[model samples]
Target: MSDTTSTTADRKLTEGTALPTQPCSVVWSDGRAFVLEPPVWVGLDHRGRLARLTPAALQRQGWSHDKLS
Candidate 1:
């Protein structure tokens, strides 16, 4: 038996490492809605809305953002 890990490029997108080009709708904690573009990271709350986020900001808020697939 051989033990090997397969590396696939397609999995990168689902891994939340890639940025999207199109605009995405996001909702803030106060029920405010907004749109964000690429290079900006965002996360969804329990209501399934895009919330503004950044690597540094998220770390402070203890929240994790996922890329739109």
Candidate 2:
């Protein structure tokens, strides 16, 4: 999904080794708020910028990153 400029609550949610809840707060490397569902992945790109990516996209590109890092 293309990134949007909108937002979510500032309330931080608890995270675990596993995927947390659906509709959890996922932010960009710049701290830009990005709300996405679980089964998602997060990682830094070649530029070292934090990226919010879906597992499908990551797999398609053969890129590996922390599931929620």
Tally clashes: model 2: 0
Clash pairs detected, candidate 2 = none
Q: Write the per-residue lDDT of candidate 1 for residues 1-69, one digit (tens) a residue.
A: 111111122233234443334668342222222335555645565477556665344333322132222
| TM-score of each prediction | 0.29, 0.34
Inter-residue clash pairs, candidate 1: none
Q: How do the residues 1-69 of candidate 2 rate in per-residue lDDT, one tens digit apiece?
A: 221211111112212222224566544422333345566655566566766677445333332112223
Candidate 2 has an lDDT of 0.38
